[model samples]
Target: MDIEMKKYLTLLLSGMSLIGCASSDDLSLKQNILPLQTEVCCESASHFPWFRLQQNQDLDFELNASSPVNQFDGSKSYFSAFTFAQQSGLVEIRLRSLMLDGEVAIPQVELLDSEFNVVKTIDDAFTVKFSDAFAKNRYELTEKVDTVKTPYMIVYVKTSELGKKVVVPHPAKIRAQESGEPMPIVTDPTYLASNNGHFSLSVETITLSGYNQKSLVEAKPEEVAVVQKPAQPAIQAIPETQSYYHNAIRQAVESNNIDKALSLLDEAKALNIEGAQEVFVRAVNAK
Candidate 1:
């Protein structure tokens, strides 16, 4: 090669070496940023502990502690869209955290419209605790009229404290408007704990003809009342004396008082109660 060409080649080699080193440095930096623990899991539909949007037309979100991270290492955080729905340009969204071992500082919640476009963003700082035994949060957002378009959406949950950041994911998809489907009667006792003590929350359009309205929260008192239906009715099948005893047994089971249930069964057995077998089964199941 000519001397000039040889010099050009030498310079090119040096530049390529520097570029490779920079790329390696970048990879290392990312590794360092991830959490040290392994097995970080974020929320997903299959493993999600809790999530519900009253209205299929409304936006709702919940964060999970499980996040799929790099190497399935607990250090990496993941994100998934919990709920995304918009019809007639109005949308309501709710987001909450399930709590973690230590306090978690959540920094942002994002909303992606149809077509994977980022339509809304909210900034908030909150700490969550699973040990609280209850969700101590309720955040909401209202968006203007817009058709549901995004098939793939994501929620960005992150906390920046001690110069470290952790994110969890919950991917979301669009579904048919919930208006046609009958709203489930909130008769399940478990629904209250899962839905922030609200037996039901709905997402519906305000205007029937125009897209000039907002999404509103809809709930029915009947739903709550049904869930709170008295236990007296459940034991009505038995005689008066037996009904009283059965009521006590049901209460013990409901309270998760296994010992009490067993004790009540023994008490009935001593009296040669006719339903001793059924009562014993109920007591065993209570435990």
Candidate 2:
């Protein structure tokens, strides 16, 4: 083959290889956290679903869970999770209860084994010492003896009876992020486990929604073309911006203030401030 033909063929093959690599990368398998959907786990009638999240990286969580379907007699059992990373030494959490129920009954937090046996009870830290209103602040739990070797964790919580059945708004938040070391954030111990366990044990196996993270991929295209008008440019001190007529016209045009600009042009025309035709054009296009 001629040197010229060989060179052209080599360039074409290289280009094809690059394109193939790009297409493969785009289609490669990559796991990612999807958009979170929080559902409640209830007893007797219904219960909130257990959510699963990988340890480490952060995902935006919305704690806006639905209220109990049956307020007369309703109890919930939910299991939220975080996978243990190799370097995961501590699990940090920020637990808060919603005020929909009108009152607050602190829930129980337990670290369970693969078989769902309680390894140890993790305390839900409260801000105030002696009060029903427990502040949802940061809490950290570190492995005292050695690292928790549970391959599968069942971070469990069951709803309580507050003397009377009080309906709550959103489900209580049970956030646990893997921390290699202790964070510098300060925490207050408001409630202790040996302090307050659940009113009763878990009644039965209630299956709620499982946390299935939606992958973060290319955004879906919109059907309609969205034309976002740019912000109104600040009025300058130049001739176009200085004159009351010009300023009013520009503001109107930029901010869809066409009527006001027309009114200003009418007033300017009445005043006869020179060149009626040029003034109208300049006022209309107040760049």
lDDT per residue (tens digit) for residues 1-287 in model 2: 34653454355445545544553223211100000111232342111122332243333221111111112113332233333333333444433332222223344445544343446565444332222334222222323211143322333333332223332121121112233443434342332111112121111112222233222111111101112221232322223212434433443334333444455455445544334335435434443
The number of residue pairs in model 2 that clash at the backbone is 16
Residue lDDT tens for model 1, 90-178: 44333444323322324354454433345655564333322223343232233333334422234433433322323322111111122
What is each predicted model's overall lDDT from 0 to 1?
Answer: 0.34, 0.30
| Shift in Å, residue 278, candidate 2 | 64
| Candidate 2 similarity to native, TM-score | 0.27
Q: State the lDDT at 98 in candidate 2.
A: 27
| Stretches of model 1 off by over 4 angstroms after superposition | 1-65, 68-76, 86-88, 98-102, 105-107, 125-153, 161-287
